[model samples]
Structure formats: structure tokens, C-alpha cells
Target chain A: MAYSDKVLDHYNNPRNVGNLDKKDPNVGTGLVGAPECGDVMKLQIKVNPETGVIEDAKFKTFGCGSAIASSSLATEMLKGKTVDEALQIKNTLIVNELSLPPVKIHCSVLAEDAIKAAITDYKAKSATPATAQTA
Target chain B: MDNHHNCWHCGTPDAGSIFCRYCNSLQAPVPNYFEFFGMPLKLSVDLARLQKQFYSLSGLLHPDRYTRRSEQEKRYSLEASSILNDAYRVLRDPIQRAEYVLKEAGFDIGEQRSKDVPPELLEEVFELNMALDELRMGDDEVLPQLDESRKKFLDILVEMDAGLEQQFQKHDAQEGDEARRAVLAEIRLTLNRRRYIKNLVNEVDKLLTARNA
Candidate 1:
């Protein structure tokens, strides 16, 4: 299928395609997959503990162009936003930005799921410092 | 929903019939995978019996037998042969049969790129991908990690299969739509997880093969 120019742009030059220090106290990691298509996406965010603002974001995805573009755009939009603000970024918005087709809509959903998973992991870690290391 | 078919030659209504007895012509709208073979809607099918039926039907539907017959009979033979082939192709395998049944029941078995990632495997999946990337980059140090991932993924698959068997038994025993729907949902989730693990194993195997080569 022909991808939109925006999707092609992101696919060719994906922003923040890497990993964060998952073990860091301030970093939250989100890993997600679509078992049907075998698409695995890893999105991570580093937040400033004192300010509760996202300081950095990165992603690594093994899937299609839409998934790659979605995660790339996700990291780009996530940086500098608060965790709550990042949570508010909908899959619909990603679809709009990427001009994703109906079939590729699930890629955006995976991106959204990845973001939520990362934030949840971060919250869980912050809530229990004692067990964080063991966890 | 409509299973009835009329023979093109004689217009005889053939309900659950492979061929029209009136005109001896092939009919359209073949029965579903299960019904075509006169088998019960169950997960575990007897392969030997299914195979025997397939061969018997194949022999009966062989186009060679219709060589001296009318054009209509030859066409019917070809159609019936195609239907028989499709039924055997899907029903012979346990997973394919389960998926076919689910599809027939109006359940979407999320296609590839399905966004339904099993919640528990997120973290492990992330790390596994990282290990895969390292292996692709010719990093020998991650070999052990890849092996560990393979083992873990295989364990999940085994667990999923066991869960599927139990769900299948429950589905067969249940008498109501509500109970059967619940069982179907469980089977869907287990099948989804199994697919992911299978993909992961294939990924690991690819890397290992390249390394050995």
C-alpha cells in the first residue's frame, strides 16, 4: 500500500529511534506487540522527578511503516510534555498526523498502548521505591 | 447463512448435498469446512478418519470419472473437488480448524499488526527485541539472552496450548451461547499469545541460522 508522505517522512527519518535507560529511576519503559502481525514496539520516556515533566523519549519498533511512523511521532510529541499530557495524546491524533489508512489504524493504537504502558510502569516504580529494584 | 443450493442443470434443491442427485450436476454454495465433511463441531478431530473421508471424496469427485459425462457433470466435479480440497486444507490442522470455527462464529482473529498485545508480555517483548537487534548487529554476547527469550517464548506457547485444550473441552461441554462465547474469548486470547510467541521464535531462529551460516 502507498503510505502518506508524512508516514514516509517518519519512516525514512524516524525521530528518537533508540532506547532509554530502563533501569533509571526517572525512566519508564513501555513495550507492546500485535500478535496477529508480529509487530513489537518499545517506547520509553525519561521524566524529571522534581518537575514531573518528560525530559526525553525514545522508541524501537519491529513492524511496518505505519508502526514505525506512529512510534516516531509518539516520541517526538511526548518529549517536554508532562506524563498526564502525554497520556492525553490519542491514537486518533497519530492517525491524523500520519494520514494512516483504515488498515494501519491499529499501528496508531499500538503507539498509544505503548505510551500508556510506559507511563504505567513509571507510576508503579515511583510508588514503591523499596521494591523498585527487585521489580 | 443460506446453505441451500440448486443444481444448474435440473434446478433441484440440494440441501447439504455435494452433488445434485436429480441431474447429477455440481451445485454452488458448498457447505462450510466442518459440515462439508459431516463432522461434529469440535476442536480435536480424528485426522485418520478425516483423511480417509478426504481421499474418498477426492476419488469420487475426480474429473477423470466425468470425462465421458456432460459438460455440466464435469463442471460439478471440478467445483466439488475444489470444495473438498479447501475443507481438508483447513480441518486437518488443529490451529487452522480453531481459527476457521472462530471466523465462522463472527469472531475477528485480529490479523497481523493486531494491536492486542498481551499485557503481561510487554516488558519481556521489549527486551527480546533489543536482544534481537544486538544479535543482528553481530553482537555474540546477546546469544545467551536470545536463547533465554526463545525458551521463555516456548514456555508461553506450551501454556497457551494447554489453556486452549481446556477451553476446547469447556466449549464442547457447554450448552449455551453465553458459556460458549466465554470459552471462545479465552481461546482467542490464548491463540493471540501463541501467535506472538511463534513470531518471536521465528525471529530468534532466523538470527541463529544466519550466525551459524
Candidate 2:
């Protein structure tokens, strides 16, 4: 199937494809997989404790081009957004931005799930008194 | 089994049998694979019996025999023969057979998300992918690690197959629909995990072959 230009562009030049220190109290890590296609994606965000904004985002995805592009675009979208604003991110946004086909729409869903998972992880960590005091 | 109909040729009432009792004409084929093979709806199928039935049906439904028959019989023969091939192909493989049963039981085989998978399995899959990426980038030092990973995955596949066999037997022996449904759910999860590891093994094999060549 022919990939949309946006998908191809992000795939060829994936944005923020790397890793963050999972041990850092400020870092929230999300590891997710699509069992249908055996695709695994790890998305991480570093939140600024004072401002409640995402200071940095990174991801590593192992799957098809669409999957890679979806996560790549997800990280780019995560940066600079407040925790609540990031929570508003939806799979449809990824689907629309990537022009994903019906079959590949799940890739966008996976990315969206990753974003939520990371935010949830970050929230859980920061909620703990020990981590909150350290931050 | 509720497929009773009148034979087109002889007007004989048939109870969904492959052939009409009165005129011995080939009737409309049964859509269900288990019924088509005259076997119980069970996951642990008898391969020997299935093969015997397959060979017999292959000749019985051969289109050549319908050349001189009526248009309806010919069409029935073609349809039955096609279904016969598909049933055999699916039932012969244990994995495909389980998937067929799961699908028939109203379980969605594909379209699963990461939440359904265990975290540990995902971690293993991720590390394997990382090793594969290194190997692809010409890191020959990772070859031994890759080989070990391949063996570990293969061993896991073997263990999973054995586990699936146990589940198959459990499914077949269950008395109630609820009990069988429980087994089916477990089978689906196992199949998903198997699929992931199977893909990893294939990737490792492909990369190793390329490096050797």
C-alpha cells in the first residue's frame, strides 16, 4: 500500500527517536505493543515539575513504517504540552495528521495509547510523596 | 446439523448428509468444517481419521464425476470440493485449527492492543528487537547473543505448543459452554504471544542467513 507523504516523511526522518532515563523521577516511560502486528513501541516524556509541562519526549518503535511514523509524530506532539493538554491527545489526531489508511489506523491508536500510558506513569510517580519531594 | 433439505434429484428428505440416501446424489455441502469431515466439534482432532476422510471425500466430490450429472449436482460438487480443500488445509495445522475455533466462538483473533499482552513478554520482545537491530547494523559481536536468543525463542515456542495441546484437550473435554469459552480465551492469548515470538524467530533467521551468505 502507498503511504501518505506525511507518513513517509516522518518514517524517513523520524523525530525524537531515542530513549530517556526511566529511573529519573521526572521521566515517565510507556512501553506498548500491538499484538496483531507484533509491533512494540516505547515512548517517554520528561516533565518539568514546576511548570507541569513536558520538557522533552523520545520514543523507540519496532514495527512497520506506519507504526514508526505514528510514534515519531507522537513524541513531537508531546513536547511543550502541559500534562492535561497532553492527556487530550487522541488517536484521531495522529490518524488525520498521518493520513493513515483504515488498516493502519490501529498504528495511530497504539501511539495514542503510548502517550496516555506515559502520562499515567508520570502522574503515578509524581503523586508519590518520596518522588514528589525529590522533584 | 439443522441443514435438512430435499434432494434436488430424487425429492428425498435428507438430514444434511453428504449424499442422498434415496438416489445417492451428492447434496449441498455443509459449511461447517467439523460437520463436513463427520467429526465432533473438538480442538484435539484425529489427524489419521481426518486424512482418511479427506482422501475419501476428495474422490467422492471430484468434479470429473459430475461432468455427466445435472447442473445442480455439478455446482454442488465444485462447492463441496472447494470447501473440502479449505477444511483440510485449516484443520491440518494446529494453530490454524485453534484460530478457526476461536473465530467461530465469536472471539476476535486479531485487533488486540498491548494491554492484552503481559509486560514481561513485551520486555523480552523489545530486547530481542534491539539485538536484531544491532545485528542488522553489522555488529558481528551480537551474533552469538542473537543465536542464543533464537534458541531461547524456539524453546519457548516448543513449550507453548505443548501448553496449547493441553488446552486443546481441556477444551474438548469441557462439558459446558462456559468452561469451553474459558479455554478458548486462554488459547487466544497464547496464540497472540506465539505470533510475536514466531515473528522474532523469523527475523533472526533471515538476518543470520544474510550474514552467512
TM-score of each: 0.85, 0.91
Tell me how far the alpha carbon of residue B20 in candidate 1 is from the true structure, in angstroms, after superposition: 6.3
Per-candidate clashes come to 3, 0
Docking class of 2: medium
| Cα lDDT listed for each candidate | 0.84, 0.91
Cα deviation in Å at residue B150, candidate 2?
1.7
Instruction: Please tell me which predicted candidate would have the highest lDDT against the true structure.
Output: 2
The segments of candidate 1 whose C-alpha lies over 4 angstroms from its true place after superposition are: A1-9, A129-135, B1-16, B19-29, B111-115
Q: Candidate 2 residues B1-213, lDDT tens each?
A: 645889877888763569988788888898899989988899999999999999999999999999999899999999999999999999989999999999989999985767877887787888888988987887878878878888998999999999999999999999999999999999999998889889889888887888789
- A40: Cα error in model 2, Å: 1.3
Residue B120 of model 2 has an lDDT of 77
Cα lDDT for residue B187, candidate 1: 84
Model 2 ranges with Cα > 4 A deviation: A127-135, B176-179
